[model samples]
Target: MQTISSCVEAIVLEQPFLEEALSKGIINYSALADVLQDDVSQTLGKPVKAGAIMMALRRYKDRLTVSKPYYGLNALLEQLGDITLRSNLSDFTFRNSNTLIDSQAAILNTIKNKSHIFYTFTRGILESNIIISSSEKEAVLESFKNENCIALKENLSAISLVLPKHNTKVAGLYYQILKRLAWQNVSLYEVISTTNEFTIVVEDTFVDSAFSIIKNLNKN
Candidate 1:
């Protein structure tokens, strides 16, 4: 049955900002109920009272209050293992091809002896990207000379995070960290993550602000 409670939940779930406000108990329930009265009435196929909608919202707020969406996540942010930065990097993206794997091997083979270089590669269905120190950019370009180069971004930096081991078990772990960075207007070029590591590649100019924002997410 499409009861008032169920309708209110449906509406709240569809609006993430409203749900956040409800969880934080920052919104006025009566006013919101007045706004949602018509929607609830239409959903229930009856004229729902504002007072009844307000009661449902109140109950929803109570439930949201008791449920911690990010329980035990703050401490994990506070204890981020290591926030390392590698600067003066270049991002090369090329359309995928059969010889792509051979080029990757050649690039690795060329830079194998350069222990000071930092590099990471990711292959997608349609494209592949290679991030490497500017010092090794020439070798990557030489290796991929025959491939279709789609994009090349230079003067970038990467911030790598050692995520908590239990990160996969916790919900909203990435959202909580990325939300703060978004709020600060930090622009991300690429985001890469694994089971226990997360990396954010950004313009060199924004690295400090992004680093500061991520380093202190727990304080906020």
Candidate 2:
């Protein structure tokens, strides 16, 4: 049995994500505590220790992004299979020898045989694919289609932005913006952030709401 205080300390110190949550600015610690308890209990399939519960809350505190709410037409459309969601993926292709080589000998053999055979390593850029998204939004939603929508070829359409390093301020601003937009039933394909600005990809129909949310936040 871990003391609640110790649990909190352990969580705060162990997880980098806790800080990420705090930067978003809208998290309530008490509410987050409940969510953490549920998560840990679910993961363990039994009641978690008091310390673990405390740790969960502390862990959540430092997170930069939180889940968004979905409702309205977009929600209905999703249930009806009318919308498509693009997911962020990590894909890689590597070329190596067909022969079985063991440990150091393999590395030495590969290096030695480097000139005799062609070994190619290929990787995909950290970019989102648009082909996975549905075209229904584009046909019926005029506002979504015309708004500076850049095509990444195939079927993917995106609006990209750059942000500075993964710091509190930068994470907080974007997290707040995306959360609100998502609540308005805007389904973002991806929200990718680097050391700087963040980029979000949404279905065409949700673009109007997304724009409105951003504009409203700016005014505030």
lDDT of 1 by residue, 33-68 (tens): 889999999989999999999899989888887786
Q: All candidates' lDDT scores?
A: 0.89, 0.42
Worst 10 residues of 2 by lDDT: 91-100
For residues 83-124, write the lDDT of model 2, one tens digit per residue. Answer: 222333221112232221222233334345345321111222
Strongest candidate by TM-score:
1
- Candidate 1 regions exceeding 4 Å error are 14-17, 30-53
lDDT of 2 at 168: 38
TM-score of candidate 2 to 2 decimals: 0.33
Cα miss at 45, model 1 (Å)? 5.7
Residue 23 lDDT in model 1?
Answer: 80
Worst 10 residues of 1 by lDDT: 68-77
